[model samples]
Target: MNTVKELFRGNIRQYGMVIALLFIMVFFQILTDGILLKPLNITNLILQNSYILVLAIGMLLVIITGHIDLSVGSVAAFVGAISAILMVDMQMHFVPAMLISLLIGALVGAWQGFWVAYVRIPSFIVTLAGMLLFRGLTMIVLDGKSIAPFPKTFQKISSGFLPDAFGGKIHMLTIIIGIVLSLILVFSEWRKRSTQQKYGFEVGSGALFALKLAAMVAVLNIFTYVLATYEGIPNILILLFVLIVIYTFVMNRTIVGRHIYALGGNEKAAKLSGVKTQRITFWVFVNMGVLSALSGLIFAARLNSATPKAGVNFELDAIAACFIGGASASGGIGTVIGAIVGGLVMGVMNNGMSLVGLGIDWQQGIKGLVLLLAVGFDIYNKNKGVS
Candidate 1:
């Protein structure tokens, strides 16, 4: 019982958001007459929220480094417009067009990063300027018009699904993949626990560990089953999974990640300890730029067009997700998984309300309230910890 309490106390934020997510899902499921978790809706949920999730991941890093990027939405719009010019107006291949767009994103990042890192400008001010600059550029690039009918290959980036290897009513491949993932998750957790025990670290009880593992595996399988019943897993889901895994590893296990946390925690101390604060800060922005570009591409692909308002207010959603997922508003604290969870919370709420015939105005108001409550919750926790 004591170990359980300790475990819960140690990971309250993570466990809390997860429980909240499940509770929200259940609440909506009941209210929607079981339509909330329908396989089709679940698939749509993933597709609709993919771009935001990507931004949330990148935004997590920025927030962790005690900074924010207000220009991601505009950057995304700009990149999408450029891609449209390359692929549609210029008749270029989607692959090369995408690569060029990403490169442009890097350049944009470098531009902003230079100001923030070297010129000693506040990130807020720099990105605010970038937001306006990029949005205007997007309008200029597209001539204030929308472009459409992206190549089918490019369209697949957002809309395509994995082909079924076995001909069946249900997607066997998805099921197999689910099982494989479950096994890997279990093995990894077990190994982590064993290592902690070996190192004399505080570890949860066997029963508690078993319970957690069971819950995770069950959720993973159930999610996969739903996808299998539909059109199977999406290509974008694969991309998201890969990105999550990579960023999670980078944040949790890498020296660079530690340096970022250190820098966020205290720039002075980090610099004194030989961490290249300027370089890290610059690269982090560069990373954000690339992810923003990718998100723009995905959004453009989904809509089959690059519009003037392609990424309007995307930065707000991404920022809100980070905070809701337990990121500290003052920075130096957050996780990649937490940001994703936060994004899902918002996505689920949006879908649920839409299903319930809620007005858009009310939806926006509710979301604003949720964001406030989430940030408030974080502040409350921080104060409690300090006290």
Candidate 2:
């Protein structure tokens, strides 16, 4: 019992947000007459929120380093416009167009990073300027008009699904993939626990561990089942999975990740300890740029056009997701998974409210309130911890 209490107390913020997400889902599920979790809606939820989630992952790293980027939405729009020019006007293939767009994103990041990291400007100011600059550039690139009708192959980036290997009523491949993922999850957790025990680290009781594993496996299978019943897993989902695994590993297990946390925690101390604060900051922004460009591509693909307003207010959503996912305002704290969870919470609420016939005004207001509450909760926890 005491171990359980300790565990929960130590991870209250993470656990709390997760529980809140589940509660919100259930509440809406009940109110919407079970429309909240419909397979079709579920798929839409993932598709609509994918870009923001991608930005959140990159934003998490930025926030951890005690900085912010207000220009991601504009950057995304700029990239989308450029891609449209390449693919639609020049008649270039989607593959090369995407690669060029991503390269452009990296350059944009480098530009902002140079000012913020080397020039020693505040990130807020640098990115604010970038926000206006990029938005204007996007408009210029598209001639203040929307570009449309991208190649069909490019369209698949946002709308395509994995082909079913076995012909049946349901997608058998999705089910098999789910089972494989579940087994990997279980094995990884068990191995982690064993390692913890070997190192004299505290771990939950056997029964508690088993219960947690069972719950997780059940949820995984159920989610997969729903997708299987639909059109199976999306190609974008595979991309997201790969990104999550890579970033999670980078953040949790890499020296670069530790340096970022250290820099965020205290720039002076990190520099004194031989960490390249400026270089790290530069790279983080560069990373954000690439992700923002990727996000722009995805959005453009989904819309089948590159509009000037393509990424309006995306930075706000990504920022809100980081904070709501338990990222600290003072920095040096956050996780990739937490940011994704936070994005999902926002996504679910948006989808749910829409289903309930809420107006855009009310939806915006409610989301603002939720963001405030989430940040307030973080501050409260911090104050309590200090006390």
Q: Which stretch of 10 consecutive residues in model 1 shows the poorest summed lDDT?
A: 378-387
- Candidate lDDT values, in order: 0.95, 0.95
> Stretches of candidate 1 above 4 Å error?
none
lDDT of 1 by residue, 74-125 (tens): 9999999999999999999999999999999999999999999999899999
**Clash list (residue pairs), candidate 2:** none
lDDT of 1 at 331: 78
* Candidate 1 lDDT score at position 28: 98
Instruction: Return the clash pairs for model 1, or none.
Output: none
CA deviation > 4 Å runs, candidate 2: none
Tell me the TM-score of each prediction against the true structure.
0.99, 0.99
Weakest 10 consecutive residues of candidate 2 by summed lDDT: 378-387
